[model samples]
Target: MAERVWEPGDRLPSRAQIGQEYGVGENVVRRAQELLISQGVLEGRAGSGTYVAEPRERVRVVRSSARQRVRVVRSSAREQPSGSPFRADMNAVGRRGVWESRTAAKVPAPAEIAARLGITEGELCVRTTYEFLADGKPVQLSASWEPYDLIAGSLVVLPEGGPHAWAGVVNRMAAIGVTVSHAVEQPEPRMATAEEASLLGIQKAALVTHIRRTYYSDQGRPVETADIVVPAAHCEIVYEIPINR
Candidate 1:
């Protein structure tokens, strides 16, 4: 006989009753019940038996099809007047200061990541991971990798629990004779991983935006490569293009 569908809050049959009804051993019935619980299809309440749980909506990762327009804004009267492209709408929550709690030992770069960085297998590199929070809630997780020979001891240090401009690192690097000329960004839709979900305080199945950006120096060398993962609901990225003669 087909098992009856149970709705949310519906009381489930006792284990013994279910085993008897199915003409199966208690161990078999218990195993079936455990499977349901692990899948979030059933819940056990204190002082009560197991019950059906409301099904959760499946997370959807949708890439934005709209093209972002960049705008030019004047900085100040004293400075050489130049227009800067800015995003039309960004998340309202401000960054919750840079927290520099270094994560433990570095691991081998994943295949996809290694290709993007143009690094060889088993090469040593320094990895820095950052969690960006808004109002004490994580919204983005960023990981940056640099070859040990290039940025071993001279990396610009971020202040602990203090706010830094999003472009601060690039500017600082320029001051030290590294001229950053251009950047390339790749954005895509992806489901959140377990660690990503926990860091962003979101459901494991939640949709997220994955962005990879590589900044290059005037000398044609890669200066920095950043991988950013953000919650879909919390961010809208804008890019501006200017028609030049």
Candidate 2:
């Protein structure tokens, strides 16, 4: 193994040489080499043979529930002072802080999204798009969809350049006599689409992490469903589990 740490792009010794050096059978040497190749630690070229692979950048994972606390501010330019949206102080924090912004749109949900949200095709949903940034760089984009009937009268439009806080929104809704019970999240990985690449500032070759979360009201009715897309390089997802004895 020590001898196998060849420089990136450097050809590895032939199987015969490896077997002779390690005093192992040819089949044993071949099996060992094959295992390494499968792990991305080695690269094999058709004619050039196997070589050491260059180390790739490590992806950082951040759990949404583990987000750092941020100060909230009220947005200006409210038509009604009572309906002003809350904003966060961007200048007071560094790039590590997650800055969120939201906008509402009326659109048809995609098939996969609709299935996840348990909605019928062509159903009109109130789409809430969230842009999550770190140090002014967009790291993720999420779109939440809810049956318009549920949130139509309760929707509060944010002022220009307002900050986004999901917890705050939940709290406000509760104050209005709406009870939120729990949230469920489903996650997976997929290749980034062209539009996703443009929005996330990542290359098409990079993969993206997709998470769909549904929030249910206390009455066991689904209230909101969100689809979150994050660049593999900039973010990570973590889950904590506890065992009961």
- What is the clash count for each candidate, in the order shown? 1, 3
Q: What's the lDDT for all of these models?
A: 0.57, 0.60
Off by over 4 Å in 2: 1-102, 155-169, 240-245
**Model 2: per-residue Cα lDDT over 138-186, one tens digit each:** 7678777776655555533331223322444455446447676666788
Cα displacement (angstroms), candidate 2, residue 10, comes to: 14
Q: Candidate 1's error at 214, in angstroms? A: 1.0
TM-score, prediction 1: 0.54
Candidate 1, residue 135: CA error in Å?
A: 2.1
> Model 1, 75: alpha-carbon shift in Å?
21
